[model samples]
Each structure stands twice: as structure tokens, then as C-alpha cells.
Target: MTEPNTESTTALDHVHRARLYKLASLAFDRPDEELEEALVSGTFADQLLESAAALENDDLEEHARAVVEASPTDAAGVDELYSDWSSLFGFETGGDIRQYQIEYSPGTLVTSGDTLADIAGFYRAFGLSIAEGNRERADHLCIELEFLSHLALQTAYLENEGDETGVAVVTDAQGDFLEDHLGRWIGSFRETVAEEVDVEFYRALGALVDTLVGDDTDRFGAEPKTFEETPPSPLEGLNDGEGDFRCGTCGPTSSGSTPEMPMGDRDGPY
Candidate 1:
């Protein structure tokens, strides 16, 4: 019953929100050494608590605690958690969970043709791009979360600078992007993550994303439609205008290139 505090426009809240999104992005990605250190060192847990508390959301605090409790506190535990992560979502380990929004989207390719383009547009407009080492596409859950994290962090900066116009643009972008992308399918994806992974940590993280996104959905007055079932990949005809993007993580396009492509330059404030 803990709703998002709509009046909570403090820079600190925005910072906390950004940190939470960044943490979620890193948590869901292929477990790298940085993530391993955060997990074993308990920095991950500490930050989760700090952010959840900053948001003043009871659900987030509870889920954050669950994640903390379930997190690995040692090297062997981290190894076990990473192994489970790889099994559930890693390409090298035949990760089966659909972490991309397009995978959860229904209808034919034409209907969803602009999905990739739209997501990339947001990233490009904000001057953010997927890292070269990334294995997933822009439509991937982690990337979308990271994009939101960027927006939230920007909101804090803009607010601190007293740039009202900038704050408005960034916050509106966050709500719209979530409504169109992450908010729409996050709950379903979270459930799948919990069901597919063996570790309690992943389950807790899934719950955390579901709650965090749900809170934002409410705060933004966004009514994103949840997917009932994951349909087969329809990546062939999907175009990003420049042939710069392709579905690679959930499924590959005929071109063999991936949607990990950079968000091309887009001018103006947005």
C-alpha cells in the first residue's frame, strides 16, 4: 500500500532513485567482477537499504532487506549466485529467461517495428549509449533500467542547478519511457526471473524491480499493459530507420548485427 511520494521532488530522492535503478541494471547484467565485489563486500546491500529508505517506501525497504539477506557474503556464495544468474539469463550459459521487452511484446513484427527505434531515441536524446562490452540490446531490461537511471540522475542534477525546464523534461521522459517500455513488462519479467533462477537473491531482486517499477508507474500515472505471454521472436522486419539496431539478446535479426549499437546523435533538449 506504500505509494510513491509524488511530492518527494527533493534532489536526494532523485539520487536515491537513480542509484536504485543503476543497481538493478548491474544486478541483472551478466555478473562481472565489479558486481562480484559489490555483492561479497556488502556495499550492494548497504546501498539498497540507503536508497529504499531515502524513497520512504516501505515495500522497497522490505524488498531491499530481502535482497540483502539473500545476497552472497563470500566468494563461494558469489560464485554460486553468478552461476545461477548465468543459467537464468547468460548467453554463454544458454540463459533462457527473456530479458528483452520485444520478447514479451505480442503481435506481428510490423506492429512492433518501431519499438527498438523508440527506445533508442530516448537513449540518444539523453546522450547515453550502451557500452561496447555490453552483450544485450537497448530493449534489454538492464539497458532500459540504466536509461531510467540516467534520467533520474539528470533530474537530480537539473534540480540542483535550479533548471526547471531541464527537470521537467527529464522527469517526463522517465514516466513516458517507463510507460512504453520497462513499466509495461517488468512485473511479468520479474516473475519469470524468480521462477527461472535457483537463488533466493535473484528472486528478491525480481521482487524489488517489480515493486520499484510499480511505484513509479503509479507516481507517473502511467498505465502500462502487462504481457500475458511471451510470443515467439519476430525480429526480421523490425527496422530502426538507419539499420543501426537489431534484436540480439532475446533473438537475433537476420543481419547478424546487434541492437547494442550506439544511440546516434540527436540535437536539442529532451
Candidate 2:
């Protein structure tokens, strides 16, 4: 991961916190263009956008728990969370992206039989799979995001006269983890997920991951590649001279928002 340059430490801290909150907000709201922008911005934005886009009700309770438990001071508690996640989600080994295929099977959200515990498990698996691919740069960005979020929350707690020092410690630990471990392999992992995963959520996630990494690097003085610089859009050359355009999928529609294709018509996992 690129080291943050010698900027105003406090300013950087504020930017980091703002970015974290923005990511959290985007995850909840799921706006189309803004979500796309967030994904193209950084690793944190990528993870949050994909996670949010694919989020099901089953995972909300667990996310809430994680938010509460992720304090700056609780190293043991944080380790426990990581351990539980690894056991359930199977950490990546051998650095072979293909290995992840055998570990994570694609599953759907089942609202009927879902419990809060089950939902949390799903998120654990999802997050772990993201970390498996070993893209160091991407992992670093994600770690920073997580650390910033924890710090912001802890700062809030401190302002309220709650324990702040421990929270700060946890934030430091999380930052170290981001810098040392996860940041190393997240980009490659995301790419592998995008290429290998058959699920729509995962594919979109890969896109988001790409976007975020690219955006963050740009912010930090690195010129990262973007999706727009890649292959021609499917919508390219399809636009007519006027504002009105036809739909390639459904044929001959007026100039308005194109309708989504029926889910049943899609070839891959829904």
C-alpha cells in the first residue's frame, strides 16, 4: 500500500473519517451513479459499495453488531471477531486465486428462514472472500477505511465521555493490519472475484472494487486504471442523433430510462 504523503496529519484524519462515513452512507442508500462513483474511488468504497449493493436483510443485524464491537481499544475482541470470521469463511492460502473457488460457494438470500445470526454469517463469508485474493494494494485501502470508521466511532464515544484510549488503540491496530496484511492482496482478489464469480452481486462487487482502488490511488498521487479506459460500452453507438434512443434488449423504446431486463432472462445466478 502507498504510504500517505506528508500532508497535514489532522486534515488527512478528517478526510479519512469523512470518506468512511460517506462509504457507510452510500452502502445504505445504494444510489446508482453515486454508488458507481464510490466503487471507482478506493478499496474501501469498493468493498462497501459491493457489500451494500449485494446486502440482504439477513446481514444487517450482524453489520450492526460488527459496528458496535469494532472499538479502538478491544484487541482481543477484534481478534475474536477475525477468528470467528476466518473459521466460518475459510481464509485464502497458497495465493492461488483459483483456491477461493473451492472455498466459497455462491448462495442466495433466503428471507423466509433467515435469522440475524445467519445474516451475520453471510456477511462474514462475504468479507472473508474479499480478503482472500491477496491484492496488497487493495487490502491496504480497505484496512485504512475500516480503521477510519472505527476511529470515527471511537472519537464519538470519547466525546460522550466514554472510554476513548482503548478505542484509539484498536484503531491503530486496525491501521497496522490494513497496512501489513489485507492491503497487500485485495486488488488481485477483487479482480479474481470479478472474473471467476458467476453471481451478479459478486460481479458488480468486482466492478466496485476496481473503481474504489482506482479512485483512492488517484487521490494518493498514483495514476490507476479506470473502467472507462477499458473496452467499448455496450451502449456505445446505440444512441441516436436525438435524445430519444431505442433499447437493444427490448427493442424500440422512447427516450427515457431503459427498463431492466427480466431477472428470469438472465443466464447467470440471480
Please, what is the TM-score per model?
A: 0.80, 0.28
Extract clashing residue pairs from model 1: none
Model 1 lDDT at residue 79: 83
Model 1: per-residue Cα lDDT over 1-270, one tens digit each: 122334656888889999999999888887789898998888998998999988888999999999899888888987887788778877776777878898778864457769988998999998877788865667888889888888888988998999988877887788788788898889888877777777788889899989999888877667777777855345635656544364433332234446676333233111
Local accuracy by lDDT, each model: 0.81, 0.38
Residue range 150-261, candidate 2, lDDT tens digits: 4445544453464556544433433443333323344555666556544333344344443443333433434322212124445657667553374535433345454675
**Candidate 2, residue 215: how far the Cα is off, in Å:** 5.4
Q: Each candidate: how many clashes?
A: 0, 23
Q: Using alpha carbons, what is the TM-score of model 2?
A: 0.28
After superposition, which runs of candidate 2 have C-alpha atoms over 4 Å from their true positions?
A: 1-148, 155-175, 210-270
